[model samples]
Target: MSHLHIPDGVLPVWLWVAGWVATLAAVTVAGRVAERVDVRRRVPLLAVVSALMLVAMSSEIVPIAYHINLTVVGGVLLGPALSIIASFIVEVVLALLGHGGITVLGLNTLIIAGEMVLGWALFRGLVNLAGRSRVRLIAFVATVVTLAVTTTALVGIVAIGGSGATARESGALDPATLRFDNPFSRGVFSLGLFSGGEDHGHAEREQHTVEAVEDEQGPDETGLSVGRFAAVIYTLGPIGWAIEALLTAWLLGYVAQVRPGLIWGGHWQRSGGRMPGDEGTVN
Candidate 1:
């Protein structure tokens, strides 16, 4: 769900190129670290996580219009660096299948990577600082981090598409226009589409495109106020994050209790820092 599937011609060439470069650098660093950590042993598990992400994000849920990618869970299990690399690979393959635009791959990867890194960091910190017993806490934090990362990415999309500045100016012109009056509101509403009935709604949607173009052409071409944009992003981002956190925490807690060894990096047949079956070998 964390993965972004934005189409092409939305972001400027420079932004796309920059995103690609950043993703490449991040992956290269991750690869080196993976090698040092003997990540080959974990490749099979990571691959499975990657496959799951792809499948999970393939179907969209109605109303929300958002697809789910459990890359946060993957990051929790595989660590941030590996998670980033795994997601990048998965996205690359999905692009081939026409899941997302080829040009937006870099931006997509960056967005997903943000989720993985933030979730992994939050999960690890909570697990260590609060200790394992507080599984719920860790889950909550993870969920928040994931959502925040996602919202930030969404804002980036708006900024790239020139909607952010437009919204701000629209708000300045008419504060009512800034607020999300409808659940389906895609930023500013154009005046031309204020007619009655379903045709009106369709026209309103069409007007959004025209307004966006006009917004980009003016002196305040960016279409967003930086401060307001950031505020809106964080405000909206937390909602999804909280939900994910609750789900993740509950799932992880259950797994931890039933299969503690799976989470603590301990052997299944072991207790008190010793493997029960390896006693004879040690002797």
Candidate 2:
């Protein structure tokens, strides 16, 4: 759910470039902070978390319109700093696999990193407020935070892409004038996964017609106006965000109760200066 499928060159250049810069800055800060910490000891664990993210995101449940990327769980376990780096690495690999666009990598990374940081913060705060034994509370807070962050980022992306216009105005963009039909067709193509095979051939033919018209018009003239584009993006992305949050909350909550040691900073361990047998018993 944290992954963005927006293609390159779809969004205005400024918005795309700005997102890239912000993500770079964030990565730099996270890297520096991680360097001072015992990251070497966590390399194997980080690899595992990255692998989990890759697999989780790959298994798409068609009806839900999105996949579960539970890097937030990793964030809660490894802390936000390390999770940021881990998410960045995973996103890069996913992009190479054609799961997302290269130009939008920065924006995608920032969104996921936001989820990681917010989830960790929520986890830490809930553990402190309700006491560590209230495992359900911790999971609930983490899930809520993850949803909120992901939703906010989706809204931000819509706003940035200038898709917030009303339907009439959004439809004003002539499909016949587009440079590439991919940008205009992305929304429908994405939704096609949920629609089943009934209209598949028809949709492809229509998409082809639109692409032909757009090809004649050249690149600059075909995309929707900023307001209209933003509106479309805002309209579609939130549902997936909510589903992911609920799933993450339930899964994490169960894990917290069954294996409390996984709830970072909750169960004191020998390596962190606590006694060996004290593991699993919260402070």
TM-score per candidate, chains pooled: 0.67, 0.68
| Candidate 1 lDDT by residue in tens digits, 106-215 | 87888888887787788777777988889777777777766765776667665666454343433343321223335575534334323222222244654674566567
Please report the candidate that would top TM-score against the real structure.
Answer: 2
- Candidate 2 lDDT trough over 10 residues, lowest sum: 189-198
Assess each prediction's global lDDT (C-alpha) against the native: 0.66, 0.67
Q: Give the poorly placed runs of model 2, Cα more than 4 Å off.
A: 164-242, 266-283
Q: How far off is residue 47 in model 2, in Å?
A: 1.4
Q: After superposition, how far is residue 265 of candidate 1 from its true place, in Å?
A: 1.5
Quickly count the clashes in candidate 1: 10
Best by lDDT: 2
Off by over 4 Å in 1: 160-239, 266-283
